[model samples]
Structure formats: structure tokens, C-alpha cells
Target: MRSRYTAYVLGLEDYLLQTWHPDFRPVSLDLAENEQIKWLGLRVNQTALTSENTASVDFIARYKIRGKAERMHELSQFELIENHWYYLTGEMK
Candidate 1:
């Protein structure tokens, strides 16, 4: 999860897509204006795993855009496939 967050902070769209579940993968990722998005930090709020292959992590990411501050709380899901973790989906928390 931290790796994914690092990818996000660095605006590494390729890495993000590579780690995403194919079933939920998008056709493309466009970070055309990512330079304007400032990611401050991420805080893990909660984590739960029902088995060795699946898990959910709730996190709050702080950021700023234009002149306003914002925080996004999202519950992200992950699935382990062939011993590799893949991001499945997420819902706003």
C-alpha cells in the first residue's frame, strides 16, 4: 500500500496501472495536469484482512490544489495473485 502511495506521490501512472487488477484496470491513465496536484502525505487509518489473499486499507491522504486544502479518505482493496499484490478498487470513506 505504501508503495502504491509512493507511486501516486511521484505521479507514476505506469506503475499504478501495472499494480492494478486487470479486471478493474482502465484503458489509460492521463496525468496531464498532475504537476498541479500536490500530494502532502498519507495516513493509514485502518486495515483488515480476512485471508492471506485479500485485504482492505482505509487511508486519509492530504493534499492541496489551487489555494485550498483537501483530504481524501478512501478504503482501498487489494488482492494477492501469484504472490503479487494488486489494487482492485476503492470507495470513499
Candidate 2:
């Protein structure tokens, strides 16, 4: 999660795409010319075991970009694939 966050801050779009789940991957990303997103911090609210191979991580990612403040609070789903956690999707909170 943190690595992906840094990828966004550093304008590493390819890294972000690589980490995303296959089904949820975006076809393109218009990265900002100037890296303006100020990463405040991440607050991991909770984790729930949905099944033996699934889990949900609730978190708040705060930042400021393009002279505006934004916070993405999401309940993100993760699946254990090939002994690694793969991000699937999320419900915005």
C-alpha cells in the first residue's frame, strides 16, 4: 500500500498499474506535469478476514494536490494470489 502511495507521489504510473488487479487496471493515466500531491499520511482503520484467502483493509489516504485538499477513505479488498496480496477493488468511504 505504501509503495503504491509513493508511486503516485513520484509520478510512477507504470508502477501503479503493475500493482493494480488485472480486472481493475485502468487503460491510461494522465499524470500531472508537476507532482503536486502532498502525501499527509495513511491511517489504516481496520482489517477484516473475509475468507481464508481474502481480506479488506480500510484506510484513509490524505493529500493536497493542485491547490485542493483530498482524502480517499476506502475499504479495499485484497486477495492472496500466489502467496502475495493483490489489490482488487475498493468501496469509497
How high is the CA lDDT of each candidate model?
0.90, 0.83
**Tens digit of lDDT per residue, candidate 1, span 1-93?**
989989888888999999999999998788767677799999999999958899999999998889788999999999999989999999997
Q: Write the per-residue lDDT of candidate 2 for residues 1-93, one digit (tens) a residue.
A: 677767877889998787777888898677775366787778888999899998999999988887788899999998787887778898997
Report the number of the highest-TM-score candidate. Answer: 1
* Candidate 2: residue 13 Cα off by (Å): 1.6
Provide the RMSD of all predictions against the true structure, rounded to 1 decimal.
1.0, 2.0
Off by over 4 Å in 2: none
**Residue pairs in collision within model 2:** none
What are the models' TM-scores?
0.93, 0.81
lDDT of 1: 0.90
TM value for model 1: 0.93
Q: In candidate 1, how many Å is residue 68 off?
A: 1.0
- Model 1 regions lying over 4 Å from their true place: none
